[model samples]
Target: MGPLIWIIDEEWLDYEDEIRVLEQAFPSCAIKKSGYDYRGDLDKFGYLADAIISQIYVKLDAGAISKLEKCKVISVYGGGYDRVDVLSANKRGIAIAFVPGYCTDDIADYVMSCILRANKPIDSYGSALNDRIWGLPAAGKLRHRIQGSRLFIIGLGRIGRTAAAKAKALKMEVSAYDPYVNEEAMDSMGVRKYDSLEEGLGEADYVSVHARLTSETEGMIGIEQLSRMKPDALLINTARGKIVREKDLVEAVTNHIISGAIVDVVAVEPPSFDEPIFHCPGIAVTPHVSYLSVESFKELKTRTAENVVKVLRGEELKDIASV
Candidate 1:
């Protein structure tokens, strides 16, 4: 029998197209589709499939892992694998594969837009048209501008570093905090390295969060960190949603502590209409579209299918996250 690649989520136009390409490349591979999330229904594929193509950001509960019998591989659709329990998959002898660098360029572009919104005086734009003012807040308050601002990035990974480069090109002073990165790397990026979050936030006119979301990072940005930012500072997060405590940001922005904030990932997707963070006047919200672009999506799908085919053919997988 040919190997069946089970798609756990509905067809992503990019991913399905890649599956077709993989079938041609391998010829022994057949595709299987799951109508809804297979979170609690892994057993459904027990008799028909051998692997899974999982959604990038969705989480797969432990119950789902307990049911799979024939599944020997997992192909993640995007940069993140927070959805799949890597430990469980490893112990079960499944090869979990994904594509990472694919999203760096597109995500960096999105972060730049988020930072631009965070630092620019958006309200002033409207007032300039009606009240005959210009980009600067000529009378009522001090103005905000991106060119001379100080930007502190939380993580120095690909996306974070890319953002730092853009920030530098804007003539902003860029610094980064990532314990894993050593002095030489920091020097090469022409960014100062900080050993602690407080040290990083203390000197910034802006903060860009690009860290991964782990137990240690959940609620990482809260009241204390917000308090350290300058009154005109901007906080931007295009990374994980849970890394910032939603309530803390609500209180900070509501109290006018920082200048403004922007978030692409939310603690919950499609946050409730009443999500206080949504109504926070100075915040810009994006629906986790940071890694979205037709070109990037195509790369993601092609890489995911290629990874799956490699495992089936006993070749090395492209970008498999470690357990």
Candidate 2:
């Protein structure tokens, strides 16, 4: 009998192959898979798990953490661990690990795709053609082009820096607002630094948000920030959802406060289909898949398993977020 490991899963079909990988990686440990509904439901497993691994949609709140009395580590298979209560887990002396820098390229690529999509008339042309409209004039017209467009990045972190490089490659003027980042670093990447977020919002034709979700950043882009944006600008958020208020965003897009928005996340994952933002023509929402790619997905799974193994062996764990 080896250490007990429990994998909180979404569905058997989804984790079929991933579970096999974990089994092969930790043949010395007994792994269990179960679904959790309520806060303390995971306590019914009857064994103190040595470690717990989960993907998105699994909320490891303080109550749930209390039930995992023997849990030594919590491994999250994603770039961000906002879904998990790291502070609470740390109080229990349980280390939390997340796969960072694994999805930087994927997220940056997705942001660029959204930026280009917002600037082009692809949707308008497709809709017009479906209606039997002919000719360029009837098809669609777009005044904003990708090249020479002003791009303002909200955070100059890994993803933000990658986005800046891509935007510059397209001949777009790139600027960023991150007081924590050094001005010399921004200049090296050909990005202008803005001391104030409001100034950047007022000047940008497109804004991409990559800031982490923390006490100071939650609801950072509320009504006042949105109001400062150009009426014809486009806003992109590939970072956390709560960083920008979803209700305010829906209102902004519906009222054309900004031309439109491309959001990969929202306040709630798998929001109701009847959500107002989904009904709006100007707002496009992806199901939090901006960090997805065949390569990144495989890496995330492998790294998560490795991290757990390291914890079991009492080795130094990589990407420790609980610190």
Candidate 3:
């Protein structure tokens, strides 16, 4: 019998890309698209499958990993594999793979968009005009030019570096706070490095977050950090939501601790209607889609399927999860 491959999520509208790649490599292999409902028995489903493809929605905890008697790999469809329990998978000799660098440009573009919108406020002016309030909206407001503005980045990873480059092109002075990255590296990119987060927050006109969500990073930005930022500064988060405390953010914006915030992610995705972040006038929220683009979407699907094929063929995995 040929190998069995199970796609466990219903995220995509169609499985054409995954199927094309998997079947082209293993013509006789059985490919099952189970979506979120995998019948009633997970153990039986796990026992029959040789490989699995999943998204962030499904939780593959220790108990679930124990059921994958025949599974060789779990290929995650995006950059994050936090949904899968890495320790459990490793103990079972199961490899976890994810796609990275697929959306670096897309995220950088989105961050730049937020920064531009904060400075321009063109949408607000249009809304005011519709209400018969004429004249310039910035008449009494403090507005700074994009050029010569200070931008502080929380993490200097792939997406962070990309955003720094774009900001530099616009003549914005860029600085970053990342212990993992060396001072020489920042200097090479024409960026200043901050040894402490508070120093950067206090000096920046715009603070963009690109840090990963981990035990060390969760709730990293809260009341204290927000308090350090200038009253007219803006906060931008395109990374994981938990990194920034939603309640504290609401408090800061409401109390005028900082000017406002623009976020592509929230602590809880698809948050309830009463999510205070959504109701606050000082905050603008997007549905966590900073990594989406036509090109990036196709690259994500292709690389995800390739990871599963590599594991099944005994080839070294690409973008193997470290934790």
Q: Estimated TM-score per prediction?
A: 0.90, 0.93, 0.95
Q: After superposing candidate 2, which stretches have Cα over 4 Å from the reference?
A: 11-25, 38-41, 139-141
Q: What is the per-residue lDDT of model 2 for residues 41-101, given as tens digits with 9 covering 90 to 100?
A: 4757723888888766688887788777788888887777877888899998888988888
Candidate 1: segments with Cα more than 4 A from true spot? 10-16, 39-41, 119-144
Q: Return the candidate ranking by lDDT, descending.
A: 3, 2, 1
Number of the top-ranking candidate, with lDDT as the measure: 3
Estimate the TM-score for candidate 2.
0.93
Q: Going through the candidates in order, what is the number of backbone clashes in each?
A: 0, 0, 0
Candidate 3 error regions (>4 Å): 35-41, 137-140
Query: How well is each residue in 181-220 modelled by candidate 3, as lDDT tens digits?
Result: 9999999999999999999999999999999888899999
Candidate 2 or 3, higher TM-score? 3
Q: RMSD, each candidate, Å? A: 2.6, 2.1, 1.7
Give the C-alpha miss distance for residue 160 in model 1, angstroms.
Answer: 1.0
Worst 10 residues of 3 by lDDT: 35-44
Cα RMSD for predicted model 3: 1.7
Count backbone clashes in candidate 2: 0
**Candidate with best TM-score:** 3
lDDT of 1 by residue, 165-274 (tens): 98889998889999899979998998999998988898998788889888788888999988988877778888888888888888888888887788888888646767
